[model samples]
Target chain A: GAGVSQSPSNKVTEKGKDVELRCDPISGHTALYWYRQRLGQGLEFLIYFQGNSAPDKSGLPSDRFSAERTGESVSTLTIQRTQQEDSAVYLCASSLARVPYNEQFFGPGTRLTVL
Target chain B: AQSVAQPEDQVNVAEGNPLTVKCTYSVSGNPYLFWYVQYPNRGLQFLLKYITGDNLVKGSYGFEAEFNKSQTSFHLKKPSALVSDSALYFCAVKRDDKIIFGKGTRLHILP
Candidate 1:
C-alpha cells in the first residue's frame, strides 16, 4: 500500500506570498495531520482532521495558517502572507483513527522556503 | 499543557554496543508514549508505542522501549547498536486528540 504523499517536494517563494501544500493520505485513513519542522528542530503540530468531525485547529501557530480536508482523503495546508519564519519542511501524516493509539504514517514532506 | 522532553541533543555509541535514548513526558492522565525514527533524507517512521499492558514494548529494527510510570519516562533502548540505526529520534506523547513530540535526539553509531 502506498504511504502518505505530499506534492511539490520543494517550494521557494517570496515573503508575503501565499503557498498551498498538498497531502494525500492512505486510501482508508480517517485521520490526517500536518506538522512543521524547522531546521534542526522538532515537529510542530499544525492541524488535524478526523472523519466527519470538526477539524482540530488548536495547533495552528497563527491566523495565517489554516488547513482543510475533504472527507478522509486529501488535505491542504495554506500559509497566507508567508514570512521567513515560516520556512520549514511541512510534513503530513495519517492513521487508522485517533483512538486506541494508532501510530501515524508520515509523508516525505514539502520543504517550503520563503525568500 | 502536555509536553515531552529528550534531555540529550545527541548520543554517540560504538557499533555492537548497547544504546539508550532517554525520553520523559508530562501529562494530566495516563500517557500514550511513542518512539519514531527519521533517517537522513527520509520521513519519520514509527518505532513502537506504549499504550498499556507490559512495561517493555518491542518495536522495529530490534528496538524496544520501557515504560516507567513512576518516573514518567519511556526510554528507547537496543541491546546492540547498528550503524544503520544512526538517525534522529523523536519522543512523543498523545494528549487528548493531538500528539506532542520532543525536540528529538540525534544518534550516531561509530562503526
Candidate 2:
C-alpha cells in the first residue's frame, strides 16, 4: 500500500508570504497529524484530525498556522505571513484509528524555507 | 504539560555491541509510549510501542524497548548493533489526542 504522501517536496518562499502544504493520508486512515521539525531539532506537534471530531489545534504555535482536513483523507497545513522562524520540514502522519496504541505512518515531509 | 525527553543527544557504540537509548516521559494517566527511527533522507518509521501488558516490547530491525513504570522510562535497546542502525531515534508519548516527541537521540555504530 502507498504510504502517506506530501506535496511539493521542497518550497522556498519570501518572508511574509503564505504557503500551503498538502498531505494525503493512507486510504483508510482516520487519524492524521502534522508536525514541524526545525534544523537539528525534534518533531513539534502542529495539529491533528481524527474522523469527524473537532481537530486538535492546541499544538499550533501561533495564529498564523492553521490546518484543515476535508474528511479523513487529505489535509492541508497553511502558514500565513511566514517568518524565517517557520522554516522547517513539515511532516504528516496517519494511523488506522485514533487509538493511542496504533503506530503512525509518516510521509517524506515538505521542507519549507522562508527567506 | 505532557512531554518526552531523551537525556542523551548522541550515543556511539561499536558494531555487534549492545546499545541503549534512554527515554523518559511525563504525562497524566497511563502512558502510551512509542519509539520511531529516521534514517538519513527518509521519513520516520515506527519501531515499536508499549501500550500495556508485558514490560518488554519487541519491534522492527531487532529492536526492543522496556517499559518501566516505576522509573517513568521506556528505554530503547538492542542486543547487537549494526551500522545501518545508526540514525535518529525519537521517543514519544501519547497525550490526550496528540503524540509528543522528544528531541531525538543520534545513534552512531562504529565499525
Candidate 3:
C-alpha cells in the first residue's frame, strides 16, 4: 500500500459492546504502533510492535484495551466492554524499523464513538 | 519517560508572514525530533525531522526545524505563511525506542 490504512473510518457502538479496529501498515515496515486521541487531547500511546520481539504494552490504559500485530504486518486493536469514555480516534502508525528514532507514517484513524 | 511539549494551544499568523510553533522536549540521550501537521478530517502528515548532524533540518511543505541541544527545543518554522497552511501541528520525540508525541498546537494562517 502507498501508506498506512485503517478500516471502519467511523464506528458507533452501544455501551458494553466490544469493538475491533483494524490497521494495515505500509508494506515492509517492521514496526507498528497504536495511539488514541480523545477530544481536544493529545495522542496517547497504546502499544508497539517490533518485528518478532515482544510487543511493548506499557501504554495500554487498562485491561479493557488490547492489541495484536501479525508478522509485522496488519494489527488489530480490540476494546472490551466499551464505555462512552472510550470514544475517540484510534490511530495506527508504522516505521521502517524500531531503532532509536525512526520516522512513523500514520493512518487517517478510526473514529470510535461509544454511544 | 520521554515527552514533548507544545506550549501554545493555538497560533494565528497572516499570509506571507513568518510563522513559528514552539516545541520543547525531555529525553534521555540524544533526541530524534519530528514535526507533523494534520488537516481537518484527515490523517497526520510528516513535515520534517531532525535525527542528527546539522542543527537545521528541512522537510516537506517548506517546513524546517532547528534542533537546539542546549535548550532541548526543536521549533517548527516557515519563512512565509499561507492560508492553506492552517492546520494542527504536533511535536514528537523518539527516546528509548518509543516515540512520544506532544499535545499539539493548532495553527491558523489568516489570508
Candidate 4:
C-alpha cells in the first residue's frame, strides 16, 4: 500500500518468549521511527533509523528491546524475554527525512499482548 | 527538555459551532508544533503543523491551528464542528530532533 504497513496486527505471546515486529515504510521514505503506546498513555519514542547511519536507539526502554533497518528500507523491532509490561501497541512511522518539519506517515501498528 | 501539554482530557462541542482544543509546549529552541488526530483503532493522521510561516496554519479536514509564540501555545480550531470530527487529538513539539507528544485530548461533537 502507499502508507506504512506493519505485520501481525495483533500478537499474543507467553511471558519470557521472544517476538519480532516488522515495519514496511512508504516507498522512498528515508527515515523510520518506532514508538510504543501504553493504555491511556501518550506515545513513547522507541528508536529512529535514518538512512544507513547508526540508528538513534536512545529511546529504547531496555537492553531487551532492539531494532535494525536494512539499507534504509524495511525495519524490524525485536523484543527478547518479553514481559507483561511489554504489552502495548507498537507503532511504526516514516518520513522523507529527519527534519522537524517533515510530516510522518504512520502504520496501523501491532498490538502485542504478553501474558 | 522538550514537552507538550494538552490541559483538557476531553472537549465537548455542539454541531456547527466553533471548536477549540488547547495545547501548550516547551522546547529549548524554536518550537516545531503539530497536531494529529486518531480515529477508533487506527493510527494517527496528520492534521496541521507550524514551521516558520504564518502563525495560523491550515491543514486537512478543514482544521486549522494558530501558533502563539508569546503564549507558548498551538491550539487547534475549526469553524464548524462535525460529528465525524470526534476523535483523539494529540499535540506535539520538536526539540533537539526529538518529537514529543502530549497526553492527548478527546473531542466529542454532539449531534
RMSD of each: 0.9, 0.9, 1.2, 1.0
What TM-score against the true fold does each predicted structure earn?
Answer: 0.98, 0.98, 0.96, 0.97
Model 1 DockQ vs. reference: 0.77
lDDT of 1 by residue, B18-47 (tens): 999999999879889999999999999999
True contacts kept of each: 0.74, 0.86, 0.64, 0.55
Residue-level lDDT tens digits of model 2 in A1-115 = 8999999899999999999999999999999999999999999999899999999899899999999999888999999999999999999999999858689999999999999
Worst 10 residues of 2 chain A by lDDT: A95-104
Please give, for residues A35-106, the per-residue lDDT of candidate 3 as tens digits. 999988888989999999999999899999999888978999999999999999999999899854568899
User: Higher TM-score: candidate 2 or 4?
Assistant: 2
Give DockQ: model 4.
0.75
Q: Model 3, which residues run further than 4 Å from truth?
A: A99-101
Model 3 collision count: 0
- Candidate 3: the clashing residue pairs are none
Candidate 1 residue-wise lDDT at A98: 85
Instruction: Give the CAPRI rating of model 1.
Output: medium
What tens digits encode model 4's per-residue C-alpha lDDT throughout A1-115?
A: 5899999899999999999999999999999999998888888999999898788899999999999999878999999999999999999999999958699899999999999
3 or 4: which has the higher DockQ?
4
lDDT of 1 by residue, A1-115 (tens): 8989999899999999999999999999999999999999999998999999999999899999999999988999999999999999999999999844799999999999999
What does DockQ come to for candidate 2? 0.86
lDDT for A58 in candidate 1 is: 93
Off by over 4 Å in 2: none
lDDT (C-alpha, whole model) for all candidates:
0.95, 0.96, 0.91, 0.93
